[model samples]
Target chain A: MTDSAVMVEAKGLRKVFKGRRGDHTVAVDDLTLTCRAGEVFGLLGPNGAGKTTSLRMLSTVYRPTEGVATIDGHDVTSDPESVRKSIGFLSGNTGLYPRLTAREVLTYFGRLYGMDDGAIEARIAHLAQLLDMDFLEKRCDKMSTGMKQKVNIARTVIHDPAVLVLDEPTAGLDVLAARTIVDFVKDCRTRGKCVIFSTHIMHEVERLCDRLAVIHKGRMQFDGTLEQMRATHGHDLEDAFISVLEAA
Target chain B: MNARRVMVIAKKEFKDVLRDRRTLIFMVLLPLLVMPVMFLGIAKFAQEQQSKKQSRTLRVAVDSNVEPMITALADQWMAENSPRLMITSAKIGLSFPAAGGDRKGLGTMIEQVRDMMDGGADAASLADLDPDLVESGVRLAREIDPADKALFDDASTISTFRTKTEFILIEDLEPSETRLPAGVEVPDDLPESWDGEQLARAIQDKTIHAAIHLPSNVFDMLEDQRASVPFSVFYDESVSLSEEASDRLAAFARIVGNGLLEMRLADNGLAPQFAEPIVFEGADMATPSRRVQAFLGGLLPYMIIMFSFFGAFYPSLDLTAGEKERFTMETLLLAPVSRMELAAGKFVVVFVAAVVAAVLATTSLGLTFTQGILPQGVAAGFDIQFEPEAVMLTAVLLIPVSALFAAVLLGVALLARSFKEAQSYTAPLQFIVILPAMAAMLPDLEAELHLAWIPFLNVSMLMRELLKGNYLWDFFGITMLSMGLLTLLTIWGASLIFRRETVILRT
Candidate 1:
């Protein structure tokens, strides 16, 4: 465990959304983090604190403005396709095609990941049981929110990606659905898959994170283990999170 | 670009969009149903209206100054041209001098029929022949050799020329209200006097269908065999019934005057040719299929182009803007496919939808015409059977057109943040496409060489020419080049948009 290789890393990552009138918005000014295989990393920040933007850059969903980020040793910018293939990304904004059934959505991503038909069917069968998605034949639109989230997770991990980047995956889920995500994150850690989970909930951070980073106004404020964060700020996780934001 | 990734994306998008009821409705149902219903509805409605107008009895107020002799002349014309009288005249071999086509052959046939009618018949009194004798004369005329069989062709057309117009002439205008024909109503507040301008006012107000004014000495002029007779008919051209009344009155006058002139020529021992200095018979050389092609050439292109645009419209929006709205775009972006592959995938689906819609609509329209769905008269004229080569070329033209629509719509729709917003952006695209696509429908708009360079208009005009069996190679080359370049340009633009993080992640 101590010698586990780094699975996800970012250094001085930045993203600036430029408007048409030459104005620019710095969504993530400077972000750096690292997560090793079998480690669960938590990104903690308030709303609009660059968590989504930074994670998106790492997942290769957004191009970094100025940064070096890699998934499974593939640079996000230089080798986006490889980086994307290595990582499974999910967020509050990521959605399943409503008209597509759970199995269809999974198969679609499987094929996009370069899996053959036989491999795709095997992967779908494996993921279907792993997620308990018995409603694989049902359309996403007809599924409950929990069912949809399960389908979304199945789609994310359809290729059995090595690293999972989940940006606020439990943001709007009910307690049961949120527990499903919690269990999934823990399961990924047990399977030796690197998991980067972003959320503002201190309870979730306390329960799941092996190491964590706190960002504020597009800049990193803190990066350390739970013991280190508590020792530096406060013993209470919520108070420590607040202290990090207040200090920044 | 990975072909497999593109295929995967395209396959998924096709499945996803096909499952949508809206896409199926636009892509299949509407195109298949609209053509036949609209065409048959319009044809049936037009026929009914025309028949209704033909059968209605129009009321024409004849001024007191109109001579009773004019009415007598009309009665005489109707009697002479009645189907029974014409049939009797035809059977007696009493052909008019004005009748054309092998005049000498008809003269010899008339001679033989007259001798067959009676051993020594007075030719001038042939009209006084008995009905049974006339019937026997017809059978005898039929026994002539087939070379002379052409004479009976005119006999069949004579009955079909029966006047569809039925006019009720009210001669006494002093008590205008009381003198009006039954079922004819005029406003009670009509002007007290039916004066010069008031007569026209009554026609305009729908109080009367038409007004006829014959010169006071018209009867005397007719008795003297004057070369010219002047008359005036006042009616509103804007009102169809009024216009028909005026036209029918003039036609009646012309027929009676022609009969009088023919009698005058006979009395002077002059041939009818002496009166008519010039005669022309137009020979239309176009076959039935060619005539149908001439009409469908203008219309089919407009329908095919417009429907193809519509077919691309919904799917393009659903795949692009709808993905953004549903937050599924980020999910798609997470795939290892390049933005170009993604765009190409969606573009292929949209292109197929466009082409399928166009082909279905065209096939449905072709079936409607060939299946005799239109009224008998209209259907009989439009038994369309397109040449295989022309049809194949026209279908090939749709490839570039559908590609253009799919690419342009995808690009434009991607800029929108929501499905409704995309609709707002793309709905107006119809007008932009329609104006150029409708170029073929303008009858006088020639397919000039320069027109072959304009994108949609070029395809439209070239398609028209192709459907009419014209293979203008230069125009075809130019249109293909222009359209291919435009499609490639738009597809490049769409892929560029797809590559933009801001657009893909918008909202």
Candidate 2:
């Protein structure tokens, strides 16, 4: 793996949903962060704290209402198609077509990513073996939660994107499914791919994150490595998380 | 914008939707089966009702003096026309040329005669055929003795009005009931009294189907040629059988009156030509095939428009709102393709589905008519003439309509958050357009130029004109251009919704 090189950047990104009756609800507010190649960046927040919204903007699923965000140097707003091509985004809102088999789902994403048929097939074969997904022929609707999560991860990395933005990828998952995500994150780091994953689990953050940010109420409260966090807010990662929230 | 990406999405969507049982049922199974089953069922029911009507026996009550007069006139007429009636009835069998195949040399003669009749050839054209062939055809027809045999063996099976009439003395009718059935209202214009009032009452009570009362005049009335006959037939028009019996009795009275007129004419030493000064011989220009095409053309547009909408209905919902409900819309949005590309991709699939459904439905219906699955008489009515050019043009006209349906359905369905919600949204859409789509069914509504600018109604009206072989080029161009513009607008609207994160990701 190469030395860290910034691959994802956000500057004062904001999203406000306009209601039908001329009301406004600010979802993500002026959040700034940078994630780099060869490292895992953790985004930590409480429920309704704009984690998914921020990731969506970075992935170009939603255009930022204000400010600039870019993936692999392509602006989310100005060059959203390019930004989308550079990143693989997964969230609670991101789901597979239930009627499509796992292989079909992967192939679909691969083709959408502009991958040729031979490369798509080769990439699918490699991911299937790596993810230990033997039931590739099974429809997504028929698969178990663990199996579906495996397919979801394969679909995410089918194009071997430069960056992966996973919003609570392990939420509601059993330990086995959660481990698959953990291992996938480590594999991405080793391969020098940028990964920005959001989670509430402190142990996962402490174990995998090279750098981390804690967002509270859509504003960044802490941005540093785990060692820096431990030194500033004590050794307990859970206490540090509490300290970060209290500081905010 | 990116055709390859759009096609990839469309191809995947097709595969995904085809696996869905609901989509398969609406998209394929229903279109294939609905027409044949409904048409056959209706034809069978109609046949049964017609046979029942034909076999029903009717009763007639005749005034005392008119019975013998009518019986004697009937006897004289029967003596003159019975042999002629047998020959004519036997000639009905000659329509089946298959019967003529049994005798050597008979088939060719029958073929020539049928060719002449079918071609609408006049007597001048009959001179063009070999004289011996014409003579032989006539001789073969005469050889079948009218008293013993018919040309076709299945002559007995031909359905005709065989209503049996039983005459009773009008004086024997029971007293008028006077009371109407509960809730039954009579028109206020009914007279207080009439000559056949008693017989009219018996007819109303269902004791008899109908009653006929004739003038009890002396034979001295026929002495004057200018005298108007006061023969009256009483029947309850509301009752079908009673109305039928009344019609037959009135017809018999005309025959008897005509016989009396002939006697008077002969006694006065005048010719029959004095009684008939003018006559009309009407002939229709439309071939049977053209007539059927005109009839079906009116119906075809309605089916095509509605079924095209229905075919696009489920898939659009499943592709848009269904994707939202399943949480797949976000994933699809995250792909490299633009919102326009995505919308276009999904639109293509839905459009193809709409076109396919309409084509299948119309094709199936057309085949059902052409295949002779309906009862013979009913089948004969559907001798459709589908010119290849007309069919291709009709299909061309359907394209913009189907595109409009796909785009609008996709746009509407995209707003809903779930499949059931989408269904509720789209169901009313069909009903709203149904009125405009059924414009072809209005017989008096001419295909006016201004109407060609309307959306569903234009296609409906224009398709009818096209199928009837009326290629109104200006109307076709107007409808096509207008509907195409509408389709492009709707597709643009759908793409706008696709680009909206709040709508695409609506939970």
Candidate 3:
């Protein structure tokens, strides 16, 4: 890691869900990880792997049942608003308002982030040009999924948050749509922004991540760099993921 | 909570909902058009139906023995000497003039009065003259056509002057030698005997409109009885033809009875007052508008409550459950906004929507009364402007009701996974409200101490009483407290649901 300030840190982050019939599920269990500024940290996991739960806690959307995760030193539970302000969160299920135009959606989010109208307008224009979007006034409902994804990306970074949490952002995307997300992650790293990207695509993890962690059953099975992951498990990340699950 | 942030959210919600055509239809167009058109159409339709029923042909099955008396009266009714058909209310002085016992002198005097009326003596100018004589003359002279003059002589005369009741004589002696009368048709499956029950069934089935059973001794009873005979008139009350047929038959009975009484008095040389006792006059003192107010008052409150609920329904679902279906909920939660602020924002939007709908409906009803939907005669006294106090209390009552609707709708809808699912959850709520809101319509239900605490019932009762110019202050006070407490509880519960991540994400 570079000698940059640590932007995201989780200390034994735990989430236990209570069922209606007096049962408990450990959605996240004592998971801990740290990321520095200017690094792309890849969280690799299959479905139902607590990848989303961990990201949710980090973004202050869900309160941790035990332990704590902090966004740039702001506690997710005790100082949730600050933690929320510090992180730009996106997930596969997150969607834009169908009735709103892209410009209106971006403006709404920017205002929620406490940006003045002028600043909101300025940020939207800047992001629109950078994302190479033309149909700012077009309603999101009628837009193609590729176009909607671009608007979603613009909304995620409207406040230019220091920490970004993207959970399977390219899960349903085709190759062309997936390329945009891969490039955006790279752009975040160049801007010295900390990004935690969770996906099951091993090739993507290999290509983009400077550091990586593998999780299964709400526990971290692996946390290290690309070299360390290969050396500890195997040369192939897919086989390595299976070995970690088998051990768990 | 940040007020400005809440307002921002509310403003956006308002803008979004205003674009929806469904909301506008419920909030504005329904009140503006549907109420007046439907109410007026119904009134006009009923009037037309009554007119049609009045002229319809009627058939009566009269026993052969009493048929002679009824036929004589029907003939007299058809003749120009149709006696004044006194409604039970009209008071007629019983004393006769000089030469009272002489029927020939009375006939000559009646002809003289008719001549005077034709010479342009109005009812007022001839007020000193006997009212009965003048009324008869006025009835004869006031018409352009002789047919119209004959109609002016009698009760429902448009039918009486024409072919009215077709009296078919049925001999009671033998069922073996009977061909069904063409006027009154019997059912083919009817028993061979003339059983009363079978005859009643035919009437009920409308196979025959009416069957008159004049007592077998009616001729002997009329000839020697000291008291009037009690004759049975059988006609089903449910059918329009039955009702109209019964009325005409009763009129025939009255004509025969009164003619007999007048002849008896002349023979005895006594005043006609001996035969008459007390008179019942049904003079309605209530203004037409007051009657309309009492009629519309009970109904108006329920409409206001129901319209308010419908108004809040879609907006609450669209903003909450609808957001989840669209998958934009997570994006909203991702902001630094508190759950309470989010609920508050949505509650305000839904509450305003409900008020807009209620106000529109109330205004439309008011206009319906004032703007010719009610006929000019009936609407003349119908001044139903709300007093400031009534308006103020009604508005206050709406606060809790709207709050309850907004919060409950949001909380319930939020549990749903999609807009259609949300509709299923909310649709049944209208039923839950209908029973209590309909309390105003329950005729004997009044605003009492125990009733004032019954949520929707309280508001409805109080609203009705207020419209009818009653201010039940204790009921109002207690109802407001009850509704306000319930509203607060609902809002608290809704915000709690909003705070629940499981509920929000539907995990």
Better of 1 and 3 by lDDT: 1
- List the pairs of residues colliding in candidate 3: B289-B381, B289-B382
Tens-place lDDT per residue, model 3, B1-507, is: 999889888988887788777878877787677778777777778777876665444455554454444333333332323333211101111111113333222223333444455677654444334334334433322321244354446623323321211100111111112221111212223333456887688778776677666665654676675757765678889887787767655654564566556656766897778877767889998776667767776888898899899889889989988898888898888988888888899899999999988888888988887877776644566675667888777888888898899999999999998888999999999999999999998868867789988999999999989877899999998999999999999989998999999889872
lDDT of 3 by residue, A1-248 (tens): 57999999999999999999999999989999999999999998778999999998898889999997778999889998888888898887789988889998998888888899999999999999998889899999889988999999999999999999999999999997899999999999999999999998988998889999989999998999989978888889888888888888
Which CAPRI level is candidate 3?
A: medium
lDDT tens per residue, model 1, B451-474: 899989998998899888788999
Error of 3 at B123 (Å): 26
Residue runs of model 1 more than 4 Å from their true location after superposition: A1-3, B59-191, B194-207, B214-230, B259-274
Model 2: how large is the Cα RMSD against the reference?
12.7
Please write out the lDDT profile of model 2 over residues B409-467, one tens digit for every residue.
Answer: 99989999999998988899888789999999887889999999998999999888888
Model 2: lDDT to the true structure: 0.76
What shift in Å separates residue A220 of candidate 2 from its native position after superposition? 2.4
Looking at model 2, residue B296 earns an lDDT score of 87
Consecutive 10-residue window with the lowest summed lDDT within model 1 chain B? B163-172
Per-residue lDDT of candidate 2, residues A1-248 (tens digit): 23567899899999999999999999889899988898799999999988988898898888899999878899899999898888888777788999989999999999999999999999989989998889999999999999999899888889889999989999888999899899999998899999998999999998899899998888888899899989999899899989988988
Prediction 1 global C-alpha lDDT: 0.78
* Candidate 3 root-mean-square deviation in Å: 9.1
Better of 1 and 2 by TM-score: 1
Q: Top model by lDDT, which number?
A: 1
